[model samples]
Target: MSSAGHLYLHTPFCGSRCGYCAFTVEVGVLDRRDAYTDALLAELAVEGERMGTLRTIYVGGGTPSLMGPERIARLLDALRPRCADDVEISMEANPETVDERSLAAYREAGITRVSLGVQSFQAGMLRVLDRQAGPEQAVAAVDAARGAGFESISVDLMFGVPGQTDELLDADLARALEMGVDHISWYELEIKPRTALERAGAALPDEDWAADAYERIVGSLEGAGYRWYETANFARPGHECRHSLGYWSADDYVGLGVGAVSTVNGRRWRNHAGVDAYIGTLSSGVPPTRSVEHLDEPTRRRERWMLALRRDEPMDMRWAGPPDHPEALERLVEGGLIDVDADHIALTRRGRFVQNAILRQLMEYA
Candidate 1:
């Protein structure tokens, strides 16, 4: 749309907030959903009027499935005009909220993909993470999506939680693969401040144990025929998420609704996190953008490299900066961490295990 073809809509309501979640989401606010959607529509209209046709639309949040069909329809109606015919329309849902009716409504509203947050398949693991859904719901959700004509579906799984072992995580992976979804995203649980997990003082897997589990999971997934396309994402050939790809590739996007962030025309901005403040701003005939960052070339380039290196594809060696940094690159390669060939630097299996550290080193050297 406009100069960019990506849009993100933030729906910040959930039945219950996950303990480890740091997203700016509100729980127990379904009563005010109608008003919230109205404000969101206003925000979308402003962005759509400025942006013409989008290539991707990602409706992500606390739990988008909790929104009724009418709410989803109204949001899509505002977005339809701003999207190209081949736009990849995707939404994120928690496993517990998905049902036949919701799945049917999503397809009717032009959703080409669905990403279910099925964090873990074990009932005990789910309880430890404060997730509402268990293994049965995760399996049923995937089945329902496929039955409802969704060609592309993805399941999100997390590892390295307290009391979780590599063997237990391996079982979760096997169950997910057996569910026949098109994609998988496996993430390790991170303890952030202000979360229930932190407040309860839950014990986490040791760093070395976490690393071992990650390595085992990666090798297991690859062995099971899933492609590790990005740091936390795997897919069956063509099922990689287009919306997320746009982000990792540093493509432009516009975010709507409260607490949503967007990068467009080389500038990044975030909507106001407060609902009343966001609604008030829109009532004043303007967007509720609370902060904006106009990224310079070096800043953009640095971000581009950082994001690109997350994929299996290598960063263009020409974009890697100085030749003298051979020491840094060589060290990473010799450690079985990365592969450097011709004009590209790609991650080896081990590199993805410590991707965050490697990227930090590259940024420092650059």
Candidate 2:
């Protein structure tokens, strides 16, 4: 039993398969949502009791919006008593599923933030990505969530798809800004192993193109008063997702439901990703966990460094490397890639582009 204040719950249900997604998700499983929620509550009763108290919770998913209002409310009812008074609760929803009624229900259930998955606003891009949502639904969903009393709203966008273009992405950013969303997740579309997109073999953009797209997005968002708070997250002032920040800060958190992962006191464990196997394990009176790891001090330190360097804030003094790092911090500072202060070290706008190479060089002296 540990007192981690952050929690993550995974719901592995989706209405249809998105071609580029490779997360452990089961499509067209609406009929089994009740049983799935029951298993989750059971896991909570057992594990949540050991989790001390919670300050933030993120309901991530194969699209949690698929669970609908009643089930979402029931899940929240179980979590309400255990949460701190000002806990930040975020739920992930898809644009197609984000109706007014559903948004209102989620707000009533204590969801303060709703992250809409609007992969691309272009019809051709959506078709290539195999998403059912259109551009209009994306706008309507954002408006509906704001109208439903959600204090914070974020939208997800993707780049490097087949039909993605500078003009298309620029328009998407403009639309997100026009809608007054407080947060934006602008990321490149990675073609991972075994994904439908990967299998189909349609050529996506090259690395250089993706890099250019990233720069354009950063410029557009920054011009609109959005800060690049993390590697792939941007937000207006006071709208940064605290739950997401917790991950970069390495705060202890407990994860629930099939395929969820948890970290408590430097120990890591992931639940079984298979739905039946997860439910069956719990039914047999054992935890549904499938794997575990104990992070040693060096690994933990390196992880802290990596995560910190990828964030928007300054690196804590404790996490900073030796007096002089291998990468020649002074040289990088001169080159305008990074900055160091008595209290913190942070990446500059230029450093964000080559973060991996810079981090590797710095870690050699860590």
Candidate 3:
């Protein structure tokens, strides 16, 4: 047993798929919720032994809130005994899928944190992304989460969407700050292959404009007393997402449910993505089919550097192993792209904006 302390659970049901989403998800599957919950618990019974004293558990999804509080409570009750005393259990939610009553039930069910998917507070942007929630619903969700007394409440926002204007971005930012949530994940929009946005030939803002937008987002959030803790994540002091920090720090984790991926003791695997297959196999007392990959030392080393550099903290080179191009350090340092002291190296403020380019120069792949 690897005794991995981090865990992730995926719930794949969604009312509808977003235009820019490429995640494994099933729409119009509300009737299968009970079966799916049973499958998750069945799978966890076998996988639970692989975990030891979990420090964090993130329930992510197509819309985890759609699972309803009763199902969530059942799942958490099963996992509770395995969790550490101060474990952080987080879940992702869609704004329109939650209400004050439901959020209160979720909190009572042992979910300490809630991350609402409020991609944009602008109605036009929401329509462009095919999000069912409007700006008012987003606000209502946040308010409801707060009223529910969750330990931390976060929202997911986006930049670089088509037809986004400076005023629109400002309005979104203003609304987010006004909400006073504990954390925010503001990401640039990407047109993933096979997604509705990509199929429709949706284009993102130009690189220069996108870059400027990112800078503005960072500045605005930081100005509002939020720490730009990670490249795309901002948080108040002591509110950083522990589950995500586990991954960036190269810790092993177990993932459950259909389409979930896990890494433990240098081996990684992804469960098959079919909902019916997952449920059927688990119900039959068999683990779902999965594809496994064994990670090499060099591969893990490169991953360490890639994930660590995304944070504002220093990376311990000794733990990360040598970069492919160690000789590039002096040049990067002299160019003010990074700062190095003995075995610890960190990206400078200027370098973080062009982090991808810096990674390309330091590692085999960016």
The best candidate by TM-score is 3
Per-model TM values vs. the true structure: 0.93, 0.95, 0.99
**Residues forming the 10-long window of minimal summed lDDT in candidate 1:** 317-326
**For candidate 1, what is the TM-score?**
0.93
Q: Please give, for residues 106-127, the per-residue lDDT of candidate 1 as tens digits.
A: 8898888999999998998999
Report the C-alpha lDDT of model 2 over 298-366, residue by residue, as the tens digit: 677777888777797778756544422635777878889889887678888799888887777677434
Every model: Cα RMSD to truth:
2.2, 2.1, 0.9
At residue 189, candidate 2 shows an lDDT of: 89
Looking at candidate 2, the ten consecutive residues that score lowest on lDDT are 318-327
Predicted model with the maximum lDDT: 3
Model 1 ranges with Cα > 4 A deviation: 49-52, 317-327, 334-336
Ranking by lDDT: 3, 2, 1
> Cα lDDT of model 2 overall?
0.85
Candidate order, TM-score descending:
3, 2, 1
Task: Give lDDT per model, in order.
Answer: 0.83, 0.85, 0.94
